[model samples]
Target chain A: MSTVLLDGTEQLINGLMYGCFYALIGGGFTLLFGVLRRFNLAYGSTIMAGAYAGLIPVYLFNAPVLVLFVTTIVVSVLVGLLVEFCCFRFLRKGHELAPLMTTIGMLIVIDETIVYLTDAVGLKYPAPFGDESLALGPFLIRPDYLAILVVSVVSFSAIFYLLYRTRFGRAMRAVAERPDAAQILGVSVRHVNVLTFVLTSALAGIIGFFAAVSVGSARPEMAAWLTGKGLVVMVLGGLGSFPGAIVGGLALGVLEFEAVWFLGSSYRDILAFAILFLVLIVRPGGLLGTRTA
Target chain B: MEYYVAIGSIIGIHAMLGLSVYLVAISGQMSFGQQGFFALGAYLAGLSTALWGLHLLPALVLGVVVAAAVGLLVGFPALRVRGLYLAIATFGFGEIVRLAFLNVRYTRRIGDRVVGPNASEGFRHVRYIYDRGITPLEYLGIILLALVVVVILFYFLERSKLGAKLRAVEEDEVAASMIGINVTRVKVFGFTVAAGVAGLAGGLFIHYSSYIDHDMVALPLAIASVTYPIFGGLGSFVGPLLGAVALVGLTESLRTLHGAREFIYGALIILTMLFRPRGIVDEALVLRVKGWLPLRAARRPAPAP
Candidate 1:
């Protein structure tokens, strides 16, 4: 194989791995928005919290990778519930902006809390997969990156199947489509909403754990960068569309990396935003969003 | 004297920032991207004056023009979206602008190179009447006076047909469209006007500080602007102004407290949302306060009888 082909293949694989991470975040974002119809600005912070939560078990007791991951997910679920209780539950039926603004307020609180907890220090987390690179034909991928990709795909697929095939999944879709109708059909709307929030936060937390493992470090400000990208990916994929988010996340990941390679890394964000702007202009409903609205 | 001047200048600039947020929130668009426009305006003004050696007035005007032009470009897509989508799009735009400023070679490397028609070497010596022998207090007073005039004008505009149309569009786009109002055009106009105000504030900020950086136009400032309208009560015309003054004063007071300031700031936002969701200047509260105050005074005499 040619050297250029090998590099391209490697870049593509890397992009896919990163794309999987984004998909997880984007999926969580979409799920929350679908259920509540409110943007949770604190979602990114939850991810960060999850990373720190996972780091605690790993760093303090030198826990195995699986234990760290479980801890992260559990912590994220609690954080999500806390946010919903504090910011959303009371204001659920109020103006849409009420919960939205409250979430933004929560974001600042969470960020400050993290900063205070960490003593304003940046902490590093060791990857369970260790520092090993695996060779696949002409392409070389880190074991951890491959693991993240596989885990994300499986998790997302599981979510899709649950949402579509299970009785609970049917109820969720019913609630998403029409709350009144769902309630009439014996669905506990509030319970479902809370469950959705927990589910989304847990997913974000798992992603955050893997993300910290991938980056090999955790910091107070780790989630700030992810906030905008996750939001953009959610929007570009069509707000509540599960498939749309997956496609959008992958496309964005590939495009961003490609832009970095070709136009210099500095211009990567500009290119990403330009693409987002154009997509918004050309297709306001997103690539797979329902055009009926 | 310089210290006094700096204090006055900061207040004036902050008031301008407050008013910029006011203009957008009044029209029913909660734009947290004003900082982006503000930064653009400041950068344009600073570049034209310091680098291109333009006269201060022309530099200010040019800055406003540049900021408005960029606003128009961004606003076109914004007009098609609203709610969280619009907020997210504008947020993305603001981030892009910040990144571009940080990464763009020319913006960083240009380093006060005089460009355009005002590149004459002796231009720095020229002074406007406003700058000539003006005391800091007097300068501040004059800026406040000018702001008052602008506010009055905006007040009237809010009560005028265009303002009504803008409000109607905001309240219910479908109803506004049914009534034959151009929803898109009105929204774009509201966005442009808001952008222009932000630009004006930015230009003034640069002149006041004599410095410009990408940090000036980031998300924190945007969040501050958004919080102002919410805190002041979005229903009233004076809400943003009051909110801004209160928030700015509180922030200034908290600054001396060090690390706790941020936590306090976050708490303030949450508490305001929880307790006074309609803001401090709700019409019903004003009326109730008025009625209660007069009754209390009258009750003392009645009790004696």
Candidate 2:
């Protein structure tokens, strides 16, 4: 009984740590959706491309962790901007499905390119935190997980500050609330859209690099997998809600870990999807999403 | 000769999948999960023939029925959601079906041969075509016959009242409802028929390949399936068919490109959207082609002054 209790606690802590990682990944998706009211289907692929660009330094010159982060963020932002320009910018507005289709195309292009260039091989990356565990009164936590948690919290707080306390955040909010009204009020919707893409891409790059560090390697399929998980988190957290994303991510982490503890490893993905389906059905608005229309 | 036949049959199967996507798409709902129904049809049809010793026609019918029923079940719940939500819901459903198939281990011994979906190893020895000694040419003929029938049906549907109703709903659900159209019924019916069409394609696919695994029906397949209708244009019934033919031909011809085929597909989608927007075959092109045809009724009569 005592062992089971310890196991449960460990699972809870670990799930939360993983949840933070998911939240970080999901943040970009939700942010884009919140501002644009359109899904960026290429979100995952752009991040994957950014991570691949970052990996170049590691493969060629054994770059430090900071260099990796910087390269990933810069390349990711550039890729994000490219996606916005090519897929989102020129298309006529009100044709909702067009943007989705274009982004899906962009996603395919980026993902296939990564797979081709890497020859589908998983590559190693440097991690800031080594594989060390600290025991705190019968609870054990890994250094990498702790680092992820710290980063997730700090990043989300920064996002909150950006959204609530900054001028740019105010313009973004205004645009999200009503593009026409915001435009009349002096906010350039196009500029906000591009800036939002940049911000989210940088966040994705950071998280992608962190994920590579945690796993010690990045594979071509990681982009799709991360996208899938990020979708689950976004939906669970209530579509475009930032606080909801954080909560949803943590909840998903805890729920998934507990599910694995009770059932098995295979149940992890199944559980996430099942929850997404159910949430969409019973409450399409999600835990934090308000039903639009 | 065999290679051409195989390619023709594969194109037919993909065309069927494209039509299925087209059906849902014409109704204004974007389902990225038609592959779920496709997989269902494949597995169920494969089971009936491989395990129960049924004939091909009945097996295919059974696959269609089961898939349509599941689609109806999905469709009813889908009524509550619209736009992106519905797409995501369907995507989740597709993944669920894939994962379930990954873990499903139902096999039975029949005359010294174990047959069924054996977890991830995949269901093998579908043997209907193999056992009967049906030539690849013969199979291609059967596929073409099926494709022709589906095309004719879609052609009629494009002119049918139900088709108009679907288009109206796609334009605006509230307005459609206000105009006394049963929005729920039309959407649900579209989903059901689309699933049936997808199932038929899947049944054909499984028999041709003689094997299937969860991975084959993954997200990539779903994307490829949707890409057809979008690339083809939504203006005419033949749009998806044209899209499927063109895209599949490109992929097959570029087989030696070593990953560039998919890259091209992605680039084409972006370029098409940027330039064409309404796809390569839009309403205007369809009108122009129809005007050139010798059919007397193809031309619209001028308004009397």
Candidate 3:
């Protein structure tokens, strides 16, 4: 019984750490979706771009870890703007499928570019928090895991404060609730949309930085896995609900970790997807999602 | 050569994929998960033929049936969901299917010490119809026959009462409901039909390739299928076919150019959205050059009607 309790506690800690990545990815997805009203299929690719961006600076210049994080975030912001200007901006008011198709195309383009640059080989990166481990009773926790959790919490709080307390957040909410009305009321919907993309992409970059630390490797295919999982998390949380993303991410993380613990690592993803499918079938709007509109 | 025959069959497989997307999109619902069904069909067919010792035709049929069943199960909930939520649900379903294939112990059939009937046993020999020294022209003939059958079936269905009802529901669910059309039923049926078509394509693809794996069924392929129909115009039956030919042809031609092909696809999609939002088949648009020589040209004055 004591052994089981120890195992459970360890699993719980692991789940919390894993949930941090999901939360960051989900938050970025929800933010963009809220303001753009369009799903960006290339979102995962942006995260990969961020990871590579962070790595190149670290490897080439022997830069500080902080600089790597900042560089990645900035590059992701630029990429987001590039996607918006190149693929989305012109089709903002067009048919719904237009932008979706454009983004799908963008995903392929970005993925192929990454593959070309890296020769489809996975690149290893130095872990930001070093290889130090801390033990709590029988459970051993890595410093990187703790750092990831801290970063996720800080990022989520920052986003929440920005969304609720800032004037720009109010304008964004206004645009999301009613674009034409917001425009009539002197809000620049275009500016709001662009800013939202930049912010969301930057968040994805930060998440990428942490993900590289956790996995100790960066690859083109990293984005593909996250994109699929992130989409699931976004849907399971509710499409446009900010708080729902947090709840959904945490739930998914915990559940997936427990599954991995019991069912072996191979079956972990299977269990996660089963839960996703069940959630979609049972509660399409996700927990805490408003039914209005 | 045998290589030409192989290429032709692959094209046929892609054509089937494009048609599945076309059928779904025409009803105003977008699915980015057809590749999941395609993978399911291929894997099931391959396993049945190679491991279960089933005949190729029977295995193909069973594979398609299984795909349709899975599609119906997913479609029930999907029919009720709308917009981005529906898209996400389908996307999630696809991921679940992929992960299930990856993780399920029953799927792996090699190097297990367990004894008895339930023990993991690897696949062995499997045969396809095209293995009998069939020529490229014969394969093309078979493909054309299948294409004709699919076209006729879709044409009749799209012109039928059920198809009209589905279209009505797509246009306006509230209005469709008010007119006594069962919107839910139409949506479910539409989704099921789309799935069935995709299942058939998947089965055909497996038979054509005679080999299958998880990577074959992925999101990029799904996205490609979706893009084909839209890029071709999506206004008529021929649109997706045309789009598939252009896209596949372009990709193949640029296969040796490193990453340029994908870049072109991305650029094409962006350009299409910006300039020809309606697609290349715009009836009102045409390019013409007037006679360059002004010397011997007769100038006509405007006449009052």
lDDT of 1 by residue, B1-305 (tens): 77646655665666666667666665566676788888777767766765666776688788778888888878877767766667777777777777666654333223354322122121121123234565556656655764686578678877699888977876788998999998878777777777877787787776555455665667777777777767777665577778777777776677777667777877777767776666676556755665679666676555554
- The lDDT for every candidate, in the order shown, is 0.75, 0.88, 0.75
Output the TM-score of candidate 3.
0.90
Quickly count the clashes in candidate 3: 0
lDDT tens readout by residue for model 2, B1-305: 78788889989999999999999988888898999999999999999999899999999999999999999998999757878878888989999998999999999987777789999888888989989998889988888888898888888988999999999999889999999999999999999999999999999989999999999999888988888888898888788888899988988888899889889988888988887777777778888887788784646586799
Residue pairs with backbone atoms closer than 3 Å in model 2 (clashes): none
**Quick one: best lDDT, which candidate?**
2
Number of the top-ranking candidate, with TM-score as the measure: 2
lDDT of 1 by residue, A179-245 (tens): 9999998999999989898789889878788778877888876777778778878888988888888
CAPRI class assigned to model 1: acceptable
lDDT of candidate 1 at residue B194, scale 0 to 100? 74
Error of 2 at A88 (Å): 1.5
TM-score of 2: 0.96
TM-score of chain B of each: 0.79, 0.95, 0.80
Give per-residue CA lDDT, model 3, range A49-161, as digits (tens). 88888878888889998898898899888888888887788773747777887877788778888888888998987876778789877788888888878888888898889
The number of clashing residue pairs in model 2 is 0
DockQ of candidates 1 onward, in order? 0.45, 0.69, 0.58
Model 1: lDDT of residue B245: 75
